[model samples]
Target chain A: MKIEVIVFGMIADIIGKQKIEVNNCSDTTSLQIKLTHDYPKLCQQKFVMAVYKKVITGNTNLNNGDVVAILPPFAGG
Target chain B: MLTSKEISRYERHIQLPEIGIKGQELIKKASVLVIGAGGLGCSALQYLTAMGVGVIGIVDFDKISETNLQRQVLYNANEIGKYKVEVAVQKLSRQNPAIKFITYCTQLTNKNAIEIIKNYDIIVDGTDNFATRYIINDACWIANKPLVFGAIHKFEGQLTVFNYKKDNNTIPLNYRDMFPTSPAVAEVPNCSDLGVIGVLPGIIGTLQATEVLKIITGIGTVLAGKLLFMNSLDMEFYTFEITPDVNRKNISIEEYLSYDYGQFCISESQNQINEISCKELKELLLNNRNTLQLIDIRDQEELPKVPVLEELLIPLVEVIERVSEFDSSKKIILICKSGIRSKLAIQMLQKKFGLRNLFSLEGGITEWLKN
Candidate 1:
């Protein structure tokens, strides 16, 4: 399955602003693994994934129309 | 003029049924201590002052730098080289003459954190570093004062209320519940490294100020058990439900003072640390006494190249895979777009190559241009 990954913070700097659609994603949780597989640069950073504004762990299931976000650790105070 | 001033000054706030006269009165009587006069603190102060928060105490030891002006809106061109708290007090005072502001131009450490926090009914942790954030948390927890916390990164921010006591138990999760362990400094980049959008703090800081008012007035669903994580890129907010474990309970002042909060979160000594300014590097280059191998470890894409006469290029991420390219005997000076990645590179190189004469330029190329 293909998924759209939205990046923020320093992660955006690596992936750039454009949303990338890639294959090998089974669900919202597995999308991170596939994206990092496709783009090895993302593997270095720690992130939490969200599906439609709710944080989803590795066990979360996803569907076709869900929006997935890759949130990185914040630097602001 | 006076009637119009009263009506116009708080027309938006007074319109809220939850924040009418009684809530506004509570705001007038509230004394809040805000730690760090950086991005979040500056925004929090702006709203609190405009809302007529009676007393605001600002704690920051950092002076205004050219870089801070981007997100720290309270300071401007004229305020450069001035103390943040001193400058913040002047600007915020001008914004609302009715409110009283206190400035503490000192660092919040284990030694003075408690006494500094005692004067306020609520505390806001706008501090950037892990050490300071944990210190503020412990200080607020010990004092039994409610905390309005806000943090921001490149395009993301998190806000939460901690230690707000209700009956026999406390409300919401403290900082510890959210982050049981601190990410290593190298793992997480600072605002300078990541490049925070200017308007991001304005959004997060206002949310923090909103929480502070809610805490004062005892109204609204305060972010007690949940952490509100917002991403500005899409303007999305995710409220994560945080459950406090046994660690949140039985926290005492003695436990706080005795513990090394930094070590608790980050395990491992940050080694191979060396820093010099770009101006100093230039002098050493000219003198020819240092005999240093200046390694430019930044990505080739990052530019406005360093002016060092002799330098080698090696991006930080590829340093390990390409370590054999550099000679171990030579004294090395690492370089990156900013000083952060260079420091991380130095740590990695030391573990692989052992400690040779190595140093990094402080503030990297960014500071070099200024000097």
Candidate 2:
């Protein structure tokens, strides 16, 4: 299954792009591992993951063409 | 009863059926306290004033900088050295003469937050730090006032209303519900370092002001249980529902008072290492403590260097690899631009080398420069 990942805020800066497509990722954990493996800098930052606009935690299952977002809380005014 | 002059001045607002005579009157009677007169406060104050909010308070201790002119629309080049709230009051008063403006030139602390916020009907958090945001949210919860929250980062912005009550028994979700605890400071880069588009705060702040107006007039759905996220890069808006956290309930004032917001937000291991303030660091530096070893963990590009203190430069990213250079026997002090990176560096060093003599400079060089 392929998942479409959208990154926002500082996470986008670290990832070097707003959107990316990852292959063979079936759940939030696998996708997180795949992302951290590809971009080591992501491990240093804190972010929240949302699937289909709903924030999810732990090993939530992901389906084909699922849209995932990596959002870091913005502290700026 | 509005005078003919007042009626004509608010004619556009009066013309709208949703905010006609009664709504305008309610707006005129509403009291709002806006914390931080920076980017968000500048826009929030303007709209709130234009909408005829009877009483508005501005709290900020910062003086205007030339950089602030790009986004803090309330200040101009001439006002660079002036206090933010003083200048904001001058600008907002001219924008709407009928509204009363109160200025607080001091930073809001646990000692003064609840007392000052208790008098206002609504609290608008225009602050840029998590510690302050948590303080404001906790204060609002204790005071039972609705809070209008706004935040911006780069091209993205977020807005939400917390603790808005429909009745006595119903408890709404708050900042803690969305973020149980403040993110570690190193994980969150401030606008000063990361940079924000000048108009991001303007848009978010105006939205916050709009939420306040809606709450006052009882005309629209408040963002009480939802978080609105907008990305200007794509102009995509998303709202996510937030549920109340049972563990965050029944917070007492004593807990808020005892909470080390600064330490909690910046350092993950508060008890593991010693933390020194800028003043203490300065004193140690002045005393020429031979046993003290200062290491600046900030990137070389970070500005406002400590010219007065002699320190070794080792960026946080390089700390793990360069751990062999430090002497664990010496009292090690880590410094960074905002003190956050240094704390992270200390944690890294402690974990990698088992060095227990590490200490992070609280507030970093930014606080050092101020002193």
Candidate 3:
């Protein structure tokens, strides 16, 4: 399955882009594995993954055209 | 019951059918505890007070800095070095005489989060650090109070309400549910390091205040079980529904007390690091000559740069990443605006690099220049 990914905050800075496309990403856990494999710095940073418009803590099935938002915790007020 | 004067003051709000006299009374009865009187706190506090929240509790231990003027509009140029909570409460009290302002001029820690947060009906987390954010979340969850959460980075802002009760069947999501772990202290940058547009916090903080108002007045959909992301530049708002993790441990009071929240900010263990007095350090500098390395681990903007010492500048946050820049073979003295950050820098050096050649200057550069 192909998925569209959107990154925010430092994650965008790390990945060097706000939007990207990943292929054969069947689930959120595998997507995380593939993402960290390409952008290893993400492994050290803390963030949450939201599929479409819902946040998921564990592995959830992903379909084609699904938008995955990589959101990191913001410390500034 | 609102007095005639109170009714006249909030006449516009009372005129609205959704928030008539009954809603005004509910607003007057509600109390909100806002942690951290920084950018978000300032913005949220202004609206919350103006909306007639009866009791407003503010918690902050930071002093007003010149840099803060860009974002924390609560303080004036003359108020620099004064405690934020003191100035914020003083100004906000004048904004609403009917509202009672409870000022806590101290940092919110594990010891005080529960006791202080339990007193208020809702918790507004405006803290600028991840450590305090988690502490606030855990405390609010344990106390069973709704938490209005807002945080900003550059032009982007996030707003959410956690542990909120609505129609109540499925449990509400807390901060831990969204981000289970904290980003490494060294990797994360704050407002100071990465500049944030001043209006970003105001926008997010006002949204947070709105959530608090909705929670109190029982109107509109509160931002519970979802995260709202906004970009000031693009003017876009997107909310993501959050699902709870069954595996995450329940945050208990005992677990909170035992957890070292300070590990994210500073050292918690006994101060085993060596310390040198200003006079002694001067003598050592004079005798050791060029052998010892004098490193000022404070932000460059900090005043009274020691031209005589010619210390190397490396801010505390960059200490871990810049460890290779320090020559561990030589005796290195770290100096900061106050002595606290220098000690933390030294700890970082020792912990990350295992370098024992580090020493913290007693009283920091401010004391050193006093003589």
Candidate 4:
């Protein structure tokens, strides 16, 4: 399955891309592993995953063409 | 008892059914303290003053710099080098002479946070650092004050209200509920380093002011248990539910007093790496130590690169991938512009490969260059 991932804040700097297309990501866990493997820098960052405007955790299945947002907490005033 | 001048000034606000004369009176009776007079505080303070918030307190120890003119609209070129709260209070007082402005030109420390916050009805956190944010959140929690939180980075911003009291039986989620701990220093750089769009904070801070007004007048639902995420680049806004952590213990004032906020937020464990002063590093370099591996974790574009210090250039983002290339037997010394990223790099490497021979150059290359 193909999924569109949108990265925000510092994560985009680490990934070097604001939007990315990934293939063969079936669940949130697998997608997380694949992202960390592809971009090793993301493993050290703390962010939450949201699918279709809802935050999800732990093995949430993803459909083809789903949009996933990776949002890291912003500390600036 | 509204004077004809006050009535005309707040005609738009008084015209609303939700915020009639009673709500305006409530606003006039409320007291709010804004912790920082930077980007977020600039907008929040402006709207709060214009909305007739009675007693507004501005707390900031920083001065206006050249770079602050971009987003901090409160200060102008003429006010450069002047204290932030002093200038902010001056400008806000002129804009709304009916409102009272209190200024705290000193930093909010653990000893003073609780006492200072207890005097206000609401606390607004406009600080850019995690240590101060945590301190303000903990202080608000202890004082039982509702906290209006706002943060911005790059093109994105977040806003939420914490510790807001709704009923006698329920407790709202605080900052710790959403983020149990601060992100690694390398993960979240300050606006000075990463850069933020000038208008992003204005939007978020306005929303923060709106939330504060809603809470003060009891007119609408506040963002007490929800986190609002916004991206100025795409103009996307999303609010997600934040559940309070049941396992999280209530922080006592004693614990907050003794907490090492700076060390805890920057580096979770100080024992992860040895810290060597710049003078000591100079001696080691002068001694012709071949076993010392100096790693520069700063971005390639960082200025004043040390030509004399023989080191490997591994930017912070690529440190983990290139960690294996370093010899485990050599004494590794990580250096960045301000020593923050270097410490984060040391913590990352230590957690992954258990590298014991790691040391972060204290004060980084900037200090080393001074020597």
Candidate 5:
């Protein structure tokens, strides 16, 4: 399935603003695996993914066309 | 007849339809204490005072710096060397003399968190770090005072109201419900390390003040039980419904205080990459007679090619995958557009190869371009 993983802050600068389509299973962990496998740099750099608008831990279920955002630690005011 | 002092001072607020005589009286009677006179606190104070919130107390231990002027609009060029809370007190006093202002020039640690926040009708969190965030949340919860919270980062910002005493069950979520665990501190970036769009905080901070007014007047929708996440780039906002975390409900203020938020949030070491001024790096490059190995970790598409005496092309993503290509023995200083990726690269290199000499070019090539 194709998952549109949006990146923010420093993470966006690293991954660039684009959707990554991965042929993967249905859970968030698998998508994370595919992302780490495709983009090796993300493995060590810790990131949080908000599926739909709520932050989900690694094992949350993912479906087709789900909006996943990769948010790095926010450094704002 | 209106008192001569009152007529001129709150004439504008008195003219408003919703905040007419009754609302004006509420403002005169209401009291609010804002914690942390940083980004959110500065903006929150400005709007609340301008709106005629009667008594506002600023609790903060930090002093203003030249860098704080970027988003902290309360401070000016002359006030650079003053304490944040004290300066805020003086400036806000002049902004609305009808309102009473109190200033505390001390950090709101667990020891004084309750005593400081107890007297106020509401508490607005403008604190930057997690330890203070959690401390304020728990103290407000214990005091049973409504708390207006605002946080901003880069182009994104978050605002929520918690612990509203009236209809308390309707507004049950706190910060803990959103983030069960405090993120490692170094991981939590602040405006100091990452650049912020200056007006972003103004928007979120205003939202916080709005919530405070709403709760005080017992009117309008407070952001209770809902977190509003806004992205300025798109001018879009998402409201996430939150419920109290069952796991964390039993957690007490003492437990919250016991947790080392500093260590929890800032897990990364001090050596992470950040931009140093080009002038400083230039002095180091010229004065030191040592040979340097520069690694450009940007994609081929980025502009303003770095003209260094010695440099190599190694896109940040490819560094870990193709680690064998470069001689790890050499002194490898990483470079990127900003300093964030290079610092992440340094972490990867350190963990995988135990590489110690890998230094990140502070502020990356952007700083280099200025030189």
Candidate 6:
């Protein structure tokens, strides 16, 4: 299943855009692996993944058209 | 028990049926402590003072720099060199003479975080660094205060209420549950160079004031377990549910005191050295003590000596002079009192001789005693 991944803050700088589509990602783990492989710099960044607007702690199955938001902690106020 | 003058002063708020006289009184009786007098603090303080929070505390050690003039609307050119908390309290007092203002000019440290936070009914996080953010979150968790967290980066901002008590069925989410660990400095450096839109903090900070008012009045649903995301470029707002990390256990005062958040964040980006936890080190020592060289970086006179390892003693100051003593071919471990100095030792070795076989004992001997 293909999912749309949206990134915010400095993660956008690493991913080079606000949104990117990943194909054939079955779970959150694979999605993260693919993201790390594609953008090696994301390996050191601390961020949370929101699958369909809900933050998931552990791996969860992803369906097609899911919007996964990569939210990094902003060090500014 | 609000004075007639207070009721008249808050007549606009009192007239609303939802707020009424009781909610207005609640606003007059509430006390809030806002950390950091930067963009977010300036905006939040303006409304919190005008709206008549009973007593407010301002914590900031920064001076008003020329660059702050754009977003921090509270100060003028003449006040540029003045302390932020001093100027903030002065201006806020003038805005609302009824509300009390307490100022803490020193930076918040672990030693004073709990004592200072316990006096206030609510805490506002407007800090700009990851170390202070983690400290504030842990301090609030220990003090049992609800934290109104707000952060901005470039054109985006995040706002939420952490550790707020909700229904019995739901567990509230704290900052740690959202971002378990602080990001390395490489991932996020000083934001002054990154640049945030001048108005971003004003908008997000005002929203934080709204949450505080709602929480005090007990009128609207609070953002307890929800994270609010805002993107100024797209002008869109999205809400995400935050799940508590089942593995994230409660932090004890002892554990909180020993953890060096500054070093923790820096250590990750500092050469990315391999760390040996106390538990892991203990298991490895049982078998690999002869194979691994353990070096103590503390002074020889330092107490709590572990004679079992038969470790070599080399003070941090003398590590460079005795560089030849370490056998890089075998795995080497550095031990210190708090584990912080050991990291410095590893960094020193990597920089001088480019040693790759160095590991720092996590939490040092203090953690070993606990485990």
Number of the top TM-score candidate: 3
Cα lDDT of all candidates, in order? Answer: 0.74, 0.83, 0.84, 0.84, 0.72, 0.86
Q: What digit string (tens of lDDT, one per residue) describes model 6 on residues B1-371? A: 88899889989999999898999989888999999999999999999999999999999988997778888999899998899999998888889888899999977877678889999999999988888899899999988889999999989999999989866786877888977777643344446645689999999999999999988988788988899989999998989988788889889999888777773334444758778898888888888776789898776666688886456898776787798899777789888876767776777677677888899998788778876
- Candidate 3 regions off by >4 Å? B263-290, B293-327, B333-345, B349-355, B359-371
Docking class of 4: medium
Across residues B311-360, which tens digit of lDDT does each residue of candidate 3 receive?
A: 68887767887788897778888887657667667665677677887888
Write one digit per residue (lDDT tens) for candidate 2, span B324-367. Answer: 87878788898877666677677656665777888889877877
Q: Which regions of candidate 6 are displaced past 4 Å?
A: B263-371
lDDT by residue (B1-371, candidate 5, tens digit) is: 33667656778867877776677678767899988888888899998998788788998888887768888899998987789888888888888777788889887776678899998999999877666787788788887888888887778887878876455356466677656656543344334545678888889888888898888777777778776778898887877656666566645777756655552233345434343456755776787625456777776665568676346787665786677766656656777776656776776676667767777777676667656
Per model, state how many residue pairs clash: 2, 0, 0, 0, 9, 0
lDDT: the better of candidates 4 and 5:
4
Error of 3 at A63 (Å): 3.3
Model 1 DockQ vs. reference: 0.44
Worst 10 residues of 4 chain B by lDDT: B263-272
Q: What is candidate 5's CA lDDT for residue A12? A: 61
> Against the true structure, candidate 3 has what lDDT?
0.84
What does candidate 1 score in Cα RMSD to the true structure? 4.7
lDDT of 1 by residue, B1-371 (tens): 22356556777777789877667777878899989889888898899899888899999988998888888999898779999988899888889988888888886777688898999999988888766787887778777778888888777888888887655664545776645455554455445655678888888888999888888888877888766778777777777655565554556878777766652232243543778787777787888635778888766766777555336787776777777777667667887766767776776667666755667778887778776
The model with the greatest DockQ is: 3
Q: What is the DockQ of candidate 5?
A: 0.30
Q: What TM-score should be assigned to candidate 6?
A: 0.77
Model 6 steric clash pairs:
none
Question: What TM-score would every model get versus the actual structure?
Answer: 0.79, 0.81, 0.85, 0.80, 0.71, 0.77
Please list all clashing residue pairs in model 5, or write none if there are none: A75-B189, A75-B190, B184-B265, B185-B265, B185-B266, B186-B266, B275-B362, B275-B363, B276-B362
After TM-score superposition, the amount by which residue B278's alpha carbon in candidate 6 deviates from its true location, in angstroms, is 44
Q: Between 1 and 3, whose lDDT is larger?
A: 3
Quote the lDDT for B356 in model 2: 86
